[model samples]
Target: MKKNWMALLMGIVMATLLLSACSNEGSSNEADADGGSGEAATEQVLKIGNDQEPAGLDPHKVPAHSSIRIYEKIYDSLLTFDEDMKVQPELAEKWEQPDETTYVFTLREGVKFHNGREMTAEDVKYSFERIMDEETASIAKSYFDKVESIEVVSPTEIKFTLSEPYAPFLSYVASTNAAIVAKEVVEENGDLNQAAVGTGPFKLDEWLPDNHVKLSKNEDYYKDGQPKLDGITYLTMKDESARLAAIRTGEVHVTTLSSQSIPLAEKSDGVEIKSYQSTEYSYVGFNVNKEPFNDVKVRQAISLAVDRKEVADVVWKGDAVLSGPIPESMGQWAIDVSQEELYQQNIEKAKELLAEAGYEDGFETVISTASTYTDMVDTAQLLQQQLEAIGIKAEIKQLEWGQYIDTWTNGDHDMLVGRNSSGSDPDRSIGFFFSTDGSANVWGFSDEKIDQLAEEGRTTIDPEKRVEIYNEAQKRVIEQTPNLFLVSPEKFFIVRDSVDNYSPTANEPENFNDVVIME
Candidate 1:
């Protein structure tokens, strides 16, 4: 019995050794497929890096595109822009303008939120109401100022009633601000900021703030076989040099580059640099409600005082176009005005205006800007020196990006330097800022005639009529002089050669669904 027991033990040991050998062989094969060291195969994952991380998962709370890009993958708006930069169908497959001031949207059928709940018109209504509701304190509330009410027609249909025939209303619906949410889930959880549930192609699987956010493809997405990659991992790198270094070392795959660092990207092998027409326009906004700027003469004086040509060449590397209030990227909508006439460095004229405003000696003022980009800080410094040359004591104050945006949004700054991207359409650029309640109008500028023309531009489908209205509005903005329209900065994106399907997207929210990597 002892000999039989010993033989059984030996047989078991030999069998165990064979099984271990087979397991090692299988793991090695998987590692070979993964292109990693000999280890177990893992699901395919793509890594991306962005300048900032998500502030919140709630669509109403996320103001910046950096956060919206992540939220966009997890949420679906009533409408979405197509590759041609026109509003097409998303959750809302089709729609109709029942009247000049009303829009009705027909939601797509057979769609499910990440939480397995079927979307309904009530959810859509709730989403809009939530943003407009004062209790929510949504940063994008200003964009929806024209929205009177959102009505649910049925389970898959909804109507948006506006105060006027706003031309950019539909486009506003397509913006990151009006993105849909799981109404029931948000109501139950009371906070969607930590995690989001939507009908987008990808689901938010994990989010580690300041470190990484992971999104897994939603197999039950309305569109089938979408989100080509198994999953996406977005990492945030605030430091430009560190971000560039990370991409060089294969730590991250894609990133947005500062205007100055673009050339370095072009010189690097296995990297592609793409330039796009950004709707973003830099300007010096005067506090029209107070100070020496309250005088139209002082405002015009400042507009003519700054050397736009020099600033464009020095700060933007001569890759920008000097313009009036209206950015030239608007194409046909852009007024056919001469940039040479609209903007020129005329210190003599500026001094004259200052004298008319009763400040021939010039006045001391503070210019507020974010310290994130070296270019922004440098531009502020340059502006200070230029203003000082004409006896203007300009004080430059650099604040953190968050605080700077808050101060500007609240209209607390005497003078602020910034830009706004026009997006795919001219209406987004022209109407939003010039309109009375435009959230972006921190300068607190308003005009009934200008508002009327802007409204006409929105409702009149006739191309010629629209151009006439926009042209007149542009002229009015120049006369009011709340802002000194400076230059439009060129946008740049850099990706490693290994990253495929990389291209310039004029619109800020790029479609990353088609991006792929080589094996």
Candidate 2:
């Protein structure tokens, strides 16, 4: 019986070893089939959570931040800013300033649009003329007001003739609105509203409004071995809470976090926080065309009573720097107003000014804000309380971005809380807002000297002379209280550990061509 038991045990061990050997052989064969890897192939996808859907993808038409984010993805300008915000050649290989009013650009060879059409100087000329056309009504129309003509010197060379020396000309050429589009593609589609075809690293695969936008990599991109990921998907989470949840749960790879939500986001194990000093300044704008606000004393009184530091602390967790007419982020152009006594918060003085303006008892007014912008909402709420100290009763009117923009642009509000972009050039930041003929002079706040200075600054080519011109413009505008220049906050954006090669830009979306995934 013992011998029979040993034999039986040996037989069982042999059977077990044979089964294990067969299984190992099958695994090895499977690995060989999968290109020497046991794991199945994986597709790297970058998912971004956006707070709002883009109103439109036509870069020349929509200037909203939501739309601009997507524009940075699917468009490339002749010139683009580097990581350090210096001008770098993009579509144009090299450019020369032949004269103060004449600039020339040389197009790169073999660059093609998403539609597989070769890019040429004519496309650049068409794009510029289309933007300058009055029928288009582009926000950039004013930016190129001085461009007298565009000439396609050759298939690869383009020349621009300016009516006068526009100092910020080159900088504006690198701005977001200068994105070049394929002329034939635009004509075929009627407009670029639904179709986004460009000579960019990514091609717009799909854009489902209010849902998500998906893009696929451009295999034929001019820059080789870039756009490391297979594709990118922008998911619209209108609710800030939803955006936060998506990032924390790894449902989305990246998203922006509000200042108040930073502490909560820091606790997420899978998330990484990134921050930068933003070029945006939040303010309570008064329609200088409207009554009470039309009175400079009333504007000054409100500006004095509202403590900027208190607003910064409450709205941004003190993650802000006091700013002047041009935000300090622009460097050299932004005037430091911290030491100035006018910006000092003095409630008694504000009350005195109000009384002098014949409003000892402050009147009722509404503070307009977009519901989606948490920071703006919070800033408005804080201002509502801050204005109370000086007897100004403010009712917060929350609107959707669309309605808010409509009302804000049309100057249909008693007051509005919003943020403005401190553009790459001081002209964009100041000239368009304070000049009398400015299209974006939404506040109806115009001064003769401000207008003259803006024109002079545009015409002047010397940097030092332009600085003096803009400094005087900023000081004069701030004194008139067109809009109360508030604090420039440090903006925080969140990403996952899987995401690499990303540093958040100050005023625009981060280009993801060099971004890669760990797995």
Model 1, total clashes: 5
Q: Write the per-residue lDDT of candidate 1 for residues 1-519, one digit (tens) a residue.
A: 999999999999999999999988987775454443445314446677677666677888656556777888888888878656688888898999978888999998889888888888888888888888888867567667778888888998898888877666777788777888877777787858886898888889988867899999888888765765678888878778977877777677777777777777777777777778776778777878887877888887777778877888888888888666567776777774444443667888888888888998888999988776666776788788888756789889887766776787688888887766666545555566767766566788777877777677777777787788777888888777777777887777777665555466665435666555543
TM-score of each model, in listed order: 0.85, 0.90
For model 2, the local distance difference test gives 0.85
Residues 1-519, candidate 2, lDDT per residue (tens digit)?
A: 999999999999999999999987886675454334342225667999988878788878777888888867788899988767788899999999988899999999999999898999989998999888888777788889899989999999999999988988888889778899988878998778788999888889998888999989988888877777688999999888898899999899899878899999999998899999988888878998887899999999998988899888888898999987788888889898787656999899999999999999998999999999998999888889989999999999999978887887789999998888878888876787777767577888878888788899899988899999888888888888888888998988899876767777774457787676554
CA-only RMSD, every prediction: 5.9, 5.9
Candidate 1, residue 292: Cα displacement in angstroms equals 1.9
lDDT of each: 0.75, 0.85
**Clashing residue pairs, backbone N/CA/C < 3 A, model 2:** none
- The residue pairs that clash in candidate 1, if any, are 167-458, 270-497, 279-421, 279-422, 280-421
